[model samples]
Target: MIRAFANPHRFMALSRWLAPACLGVGALLMVWSVWQGLWVVPHDDYQGGDIMRAMFVHVPSAWLAMASYMGLAATGLIWFVWRHELADMAAKSIAPLGAAYTAMCLATGSIWGKPTWGTWWLWDDARMMSVLVMFFLFLGYMALRAAMETRQKAARAGAILAMVGAVNVPLIKFSVDIWSSIHQDASVLRLDGPAMPPVYLTPLLIGGLAHMIFFAGLTMMLMRAEVWGRRGDVLIARKLSGA
Candidate 1:
């Protein structure tokens, strides 16, 4: 499957339709889920209450922050091993989006924490600290890639860096369990099944799906642009050399 997408023609053909389809479906689902969460679902009786609504964005952003990094690792691996053009483009394109998602997750988490915990930020929480590190890794990868003069060299460096930084993904996932943390344990992804009620869980699931699809669509569009942009650069260089 990875090798199949390595072919540019196949990738372009699929992305032409798939990108728009994903964006459309994702946007619709997000609207529906937000409406359901805000207007339809009853507020929690606990301290969380209506404030928990932030989870609609916070949870999905956190999940995608991890997911996008995993994608970066996969594409980076493909580029490192096979030197596939599409894979390189994909890994590069995903970095900024992953960074944006991570930032959103942290910001929204702080917003929720302020009301519930009576504090906007907690330096001691393992989960919080780990995710902040993940965000910095994204920034570092982008900066490192940009500092190189040649795209190939940049890609090589970025791919290696991304793979190495992937260690943070697992840490972010299990940080609450591995160390002392105020963050709640996994509720939606637990082995015993979701710990939350149906009313809250349903919207959360939809929101997660929406974020995943939107990220896919956005990533594909960026990959397509990178391919074209690279081709244009090659053409310009050839013309200049001829002149």
Candidate 2:
């Protein structure tokens, strides 16, 4: 299936149909989830009812932030090994998306922390620092790509950085388990069960799926734009050389 879709034209055609559908469904799901999470679901017993609700957005964003970077790193590896233009473009396109999610994670985390942890921020936590490192990795990839003159060189360098930075992803996931941090341990991904109630869990799952779809749509759009821009540049260069 992957090999079948390796052709750019086929991929683009599929994207054209899939992107809009994903976006529409994602938007609807997100709105529904937010409504359910905020109004329909019962409040937490311990934390102020409304405050715990932020998990609907915060947790998913944090998960995606890490997931997106891992995707970028994987694409970067493909680009470096196969010298695939599409893979390189994908890596470039995903950087900002990863960064945006990372930022959302941190902001929502801080908001959640202020009431829960009694502080807006903390340095002692490994998870927090790991997230910060992921953010910097996104920034570093974008900056390095932008600064380089040639696309190939930029992609190569960025790929190296991405792969190196991927080490922090595992650290972020395992941080709570590894250290005696204030951050709560795994709830959603636990072996036994999720701690959240059914009402809250329903919306959380809905919102998370919505966010993933939204990210896919956005990444496809950005990749298409980058591919088009690069093709245009090539055309312009050819024209100038011919003239």
User: For model 2, how many clashes?
Assistant: 0
Native-to-model Cα distance after best TM-score fit, residue 186 in candidate 1, in Å: 19
Worst 10 residues of 1 by lDDT: 185-194
Query: Which number leads on TM-score?
Result: 1
Off by over 4 Å in 1: 168-194
Q: How much lDDT does candidate 1 score?
A: 0.86
- Stretches of candidate 2 off by over 4 Å are 171-194
List, residue by residue over 1-243, the lDDT tens digit for candidate 1: 877888998998999999999999999999888888878888864646788788888889999998888899989999999999899999999999999999999999898888777788866666677778889999999999999999999999999998888865675558644654444442222213436888888999999999999999999999999988988999999999999
Tens digits of per-residue lDDT for model 2, 1-243: 445655678768888888788888888998999888788888874654578888889878988997899899999888778777778878888999999999999998888777777778866556667788788889988999899998878999999989887876676558644663554442222212446667777899989999999898888888778767878999999999999
- TM-score, per-candidate, Cα-based: 0.90, 0.88
lDDT of prediction 2: 0.81
Sliding window of 10 residues with minimal summed lDDT for model 2 = 185-194
